[model samples]
Target chain A: MTADVQTLASESGCHLFSGCGFPSPGLNVFEFKPIFSIGAFDFTKPMLLALISMLLVIGFFWSAFAKPKMVPRGAQNVGELGYLFVRDNISRETIGKKGDPYVPFLFSIFFFVWVMNVMAIIPFAQFPATSRIAFPASIVGIVWVTYLVLGIKNQGFVGYFKNMMFPPGLPKAIYFLLAPIELLQGLITRPFTMAVRLFANMFAGHMLIVTFSVGAWYLLGFHIGALYSATSFIVVVVLTAFELMIQALQAYIITLLAASYISTSLEAEH
Target chain B: MDGAAWSSVGYLLSGMLIYGGIGWLIDRWTGHSALFLPIGLVVGIALALVLVFVRHGRSS
Candidate 1:
């Protein structure tokens, strides 16, 4: 059954988008010229989609929260829910007592990311903005820079450098090897991984859905293996439910991790 | 032989595990939990492209 489904995906042509003879899993179908480039930076189709999604999200909530009703109605409620979710659930949970001050910043990150991921599920406009590495990486770079700048800004350069280098409560022998290694990690690896997490998950998830969707279409072609084809129908249904859960979970995870990073940095102890 | 093929498969998975181990080390060092995937995909892909298109193929 699995073998047959695999064969279906390989041959299926749903005409969703031109994938440049590459296995795009049918996500990026539209082609557009680059808008502008600053030095090495080239803005492409994905960036445009992200911008539009940002506008749409802002517009939706602006209209929602423009007037504060006595009893919260429509957009205000939704916006408030978003703010409360990240502020209370994520920031407080991660950062504990000191979370209130950082609530606004974390709320912005969480919503922007969640909205970008939700863009994929939006009908007619089916693009996951965060799937584009540039968008997520840019956000990650921002967060990484925030932590570095804030850490140094709050704790003087020497103090922050020392804080990162010799994390409190490490064995004495380990410091010899750990300091340079820790510095290297702080300087390089932190931001790199943060950006990649959102990029990989959304990228892979979208591809998988497209692959299966196209496979389902492909299987409807043959008569003899109709029973197995029916399973594709079932599989799609199951995967959709799983994908919805995962989509939200991934956004929560990204924000949760970000808050936790901030929380740990705020702590003097490890 | 078939044993060599199976051994190579084992080696590949183990390599991924080891790579992940190193990544976890970086995460622990930096106090940032999620940090490896972006480095691997975005920066790593760019590095590969530079290596291929701009670096190796170019001359001093």
Candidate 2:
């Protein structure tokens, strides 16, 4: 099967490049050699990007809010805009008035995801840290644990499970059929989709950018191919702009979903 | 509203995964092919719709 796939791939590559060696890009680009290792720990490009993104977030927020300004200026003004954006747009919109307390959590997630995704466009660090499933999976894990704990804490263990598995006001007999789905969705699919949604977006975005970039380079090899190279370069430019919007939108969506889950856990009924 | 819509998708996906997976297992066990998959998919969608209506369609 692997050989068949490779043959088909090479055939397609030849068809596209008219027998020229196109040097088609693949998943190999995502793989990286460890820069240095600390025993079991391996530091690589994506890991470095993640670390840098985290430090940037921390430093930016620290400078913005570390000193409380009665009249906001400089970093405080910028920080307030980000804080208020998350508070009003995501948290309050999703969770209502009581969402003020969770603003910090949602805000951090939104910006962290946004900055990590934005790295895909940054020169020299052209990789989205969230493209690695581990990062989004870990974030979703934290979200899962948070909402689960909140539900059990506020509603009691048995009550929370009951409320989650069996929606109130449903007919008694239908609960048997629906219970499994509800349980599976709540326990498994919720976090799974949450992580996959972000990871898949970043992964696909990175793949597209890489493909267009390589296409442009390969097409520029011949005089007649210059037009194709120019077209591919234009696509690369347009896609980069589009990717910027998607990165921010995905961050907003994940944070909004987190808030929604938290609010659902807190509520007595769906 | 958007939250409800997104979770509704989760409901649909989980419904299909759980029921369709069980159907596939049954097919494997019985050596029957393609028989249960369609049934599972339809039932999954039906149940997901009902759940969505209960969660979002009704006035709270």
Each candidate structure's TM-score, on Cα atoms with residue i matched to residue i, is 0.69, 0.91
Model 2 residue A63 CA deviation (Å) reads 0.7
TM-scores computed on chain B for all candidates: 0.50, 0.91
Residue pairs that clash (backbone atoms under 3 angstroms), model 1: A17-A29, A64-A75, A64-A76, A192-B39, A193-B35, A193-B36, A194-B35, A196-B37, A196-B38
lDDT of 2 by residue, A1-270 (tens): 122223334455432356667656677667777989999999988889999999999999999888888999999998899999999989888789988888888988999999999999997788898999999999999999999999999899998889999999978999999999999989998899899999999999988888777777667645778899889989989999999999999999999999998988887664
What lDDT is reached at residue B30 by model 2? 84
Error of 2 at A167 (Å): 1.3
* Candidate 1 per-residue lDDT over residues A1-270, each given as its tens digit: 222234344564422233323233443333335778878877865687778867877787788778879799777888888888888888877678687888877776777787788766565445577888878888877777777777777777888888766755546785564455455445555455557777888877666665665555555544644555577668766766676777687678767766765764675434
Instruction: Give me the runs in candidate 2 sitting further than 4 Å from their true place.
Output: A1-19
Candidate 1 regions with alpha-carbon error over 4 angstroms = A1-44, B1-60
Q: Highest DockQ, which number?
A: 2
Candidate that scores best on TM-score:
2
Interface RMSD of each: 16.6, 0.8
